[model samples]
Target: MSSGSFIMSILDEAPTLAQPRSTPKHEFKGHKSNIWSFVFLHDNVHIVSGSEDGMMCKWDCDTGLLVGEPWESEGGSINALALSPDGKTISCGRYNGSVEMWNTDGEMSEDILTGHTTWVSALSWSPSGAHIASGSNDGIILIQKAGNGEVEPEVGLMKMRQLEGRVMCLAYSHLGDRIASGAYNKTICILDNNTGKLLVGPIEDLGGLMKSVVWSLDDSKLYSASDKFARVFDSTEGTELYRFEHESFIYSVALSPKHNVLACVGEDGVAQLWDTESHEPLGQLFHQEDRKLLRCMSFSRDGQYLAYGGDHENITLWVLRVIAPELLVRAFMIILQVEKPYSRTLHPCLHHSPASRQVLSP
Candidate 1:
């Protein structure tokens, strides 16, 4: 569609390679510090990014334009941010080990989640958004109940669990039930959010710090990238599927809406695409720099755009190709992008919806 775009930044956008990754069609700028985290929300129109800049910015994903002035969190470089599923609230992690919640619709701090001894590096919310999970450099994952109308933090819906190392990346299943977390210790821990028990992992495959984790759209399985390659696994069986190796350190990986595609962005400054079914490595997607590290990435809610964030602090959002439903169902309801608009659970392409409670792998 549109031509490449630009955003005047704190640091000038560097010259990119002569090849295809060209210029970011859109660029969102504001973070004063390194931005290693970002998440999409609101029909994919908005993006919330946290940075060492001591602020979290909510911006227009389409134009890389600020929705309003960046919100001041004051806790210091906010490297972790998660938007509630309902799009009503926002959760941010600060450098000094504190997690705070903001009413995104209202733009105010309504809940404060505290407990870690180090900076909170990753955070997530249950599908229902009734439960909030935050992990920190302290090597602990704090589970908190979203404050029920200003109720005391104790009575609020929350819980806490311990992990082996600095918790870095977190993802909930499509159904919003199970949470798979990646940590600095190179382990991916799959937990039952309701039971609050370690269901799996220290299920290690991530060779480096697991920077990003995500499940298929239906939440049956998971895929994670640890700076080396993106690995796919059966969330139910705890089995490895495929490791899409990277040319450089892979820092972020995202699954398309149908779960048939995996896009992993590497710090080596290139992003690779893989066929989830064949487990074969496709080509790569490069960005503005020769080897500048890209910190985060996500597929748009509509599953048509692939966005990546970098150490340079600018975000690159790309519109991508689409694939229709590929499901061949067996039990309950599992929604997917069908070729036609007929509405029953379509063919199961490769979805990962974990919140359905019990998941069975084919």
Candidate 2:
């Protein structure tokens, strides 16, 4: 087929567009207090969230309804959550400095693990699913066995390290060989996942308190959100690569599980998407007018859905497939011909506005 014919055929396969609405597709209502954290299950349809109300609830994103009974936290104020790689287990960190594990089958089997003396603020399950890492307000990060609730000094507890500030966020590298952590002291650290040795930092002098950290899919770079900027860094050298600046303090940063898009929300209550490769805004933005801060967010495994929550009692799920039909088509084009340059003028369907056509990145 001629090159023009091939491009036309690809555009023909683009899905139909729905009238975009500024409102969220689904607002999952259950938590009575601020929603702090959440994660999408491997199925990509169910999402589990933890909140300041000390409850963890699972919701079916497709139906916008609760999946089963909400699990009450033994420790008050569940602060963070992580799901095992197999998706069968979810680990919850609470304000009481304890980590609780539950089976996803709706059976509330409590394998409570305790060590830190204050709030457990962050949790990350190793990509291999063999270990769970919990970070606490006490400035400690503990690695323990995921099975049988082992924290025994000799058998279950694998490694532990103390940081200079309250650990705010933690994320395991895709390769599971390292962990990147952000702390309240305005520092970022990369530690060897097995030995608990600091491999890269206490890399200090970051612009502000580190709010979130995530590794590139290839594990070569790390991304973090702070006061007024989200930065890119070399995962191995601990060097800054670039930054995305915002008008307000950034609360969270999430990379799509299957795409090179990065999504972040801030104190301005506006969520922005960016091209991870080019470090440019993707033109699609979601604004939450009711809330001043969007504290947390997660992307579905398929990269077609997004969930974000904050000071409000509910989480909002955005169906990207419906909200940005042309954006997804541009994403498809990027994946297919990343090396080729294209004219800035977008297809007629994407000509809704000059801002919407920004996804036609070269």
Candidate 3:
């Protein structure tokens, strides 16, 4: 259709695209066991993942090549992973109740941070890259200074909080003022980042066991994933703002840094999207034929790519280009460009082939 015709149709109502099956642009495949957690490097050039195989691998995002040899975790299977805001440091929480640090250049540090009595389950880096907040199966949370390649017996330790159940997930607000944590007790807590003082809850009655939590770009709201729902709450009041229901147990939740879109993945083997402002489900659902239960999810800094893995040995990466009313302002239609196996001419229409989910064979 002509550009003039495209503009008019979009002004009325955007065309709907068919659900997309799992077609990853790249699948990094070095891990020998289930992938547990991963993080995008601050520069958005590389991705680092830790798995049940007790190994951490870094892959170049552009080329999909392993940057170097995988780094073996000293403690045990890694349960959580976090990268410093500056991308200079990597922190991994292990099953052995310990947290270790490594520079992005593949250099492991000498000092190990330890205090939790059981498995270390979650971790988040302070916005300034100076501190780290960690959660463990032992129901303890610690806010400590990040390692600088030296050990001094909790030298930079800041504060600690003991909860009633395993701490499952944590996120530092973009404003750097507070931290949010979700636990097995079905509660979400907000604490002052500096003093580690409880600012909010133990906010109870979330639909189910808390799995993941993240802060809005401005830090005014918090998004969390639980049993079968992805919830949004007011950061200061800890009040429920909205909840998006899922078809299966939701294991992970991620927010686009540059857009108002939230992505979620779970047991159904589908990745779903929701508009943060409208809280309405998007038209596309990313799925795979194997139906692996996805336990981890993350969006790149620019909101142009998404990565997820779990119950599988490889991490899948997708290129996402979203065209929507909120983003374009003048455009009424929502168009999504997900890298596919076959190339097609760029069209302005809203409908696309339903068979766009074929991944390129490795």
Among these predictions, the greatest lDDT belongs to: 2
Give per-residue CA lDDT, model 2, range 23-77, as digits (tens).
Answer: 6778889898988898889898998988999988889988999987898846899
List per-prediction Cα lDDT, in the order shown: 0.67, 0.79, 0.77
Give lDDT for model 1: 0.67
Better of 1 and 2 by lDDT: 2
- Shift in Å, residue 260, candidate 2: 1.6
Lowest summed-lDDT stretch of 10 residues in model 3?
353-362
The TM-score obtained by model 1 is 0.76
Deviation from native of the Cα of residue 146 in model 2, angstroms: 1.0
- What would the per-residue lDDT of candidate 1 be over residues 1-362, giving only the tens digit for each residue? 11111111200232211113344557787776677777777677877777777777777866679887877856877778788888777788888887788766437665677777889888888788777777777777667777742323432222333456678877777676677888777788887766656777667645687888888877877888885777778898778877777788888887877446788777777776777876754333556565678887877777656788777777777655311111112111232222223333222231333311122243
> How high is the lDDT of residue 108 in model 1?
60
Candidate order, TM-score descending: 2, 3, 1
Error of 1 at 209 (Å): 1.9
Better of 2 and 3 by lDDT: 2
Model 3 TM-score, all chains together? 0.82
Q: Which portions of model 1 miss their true places by more than 4 Å?
A: 1-22, 148-162, 280-284, 322-362
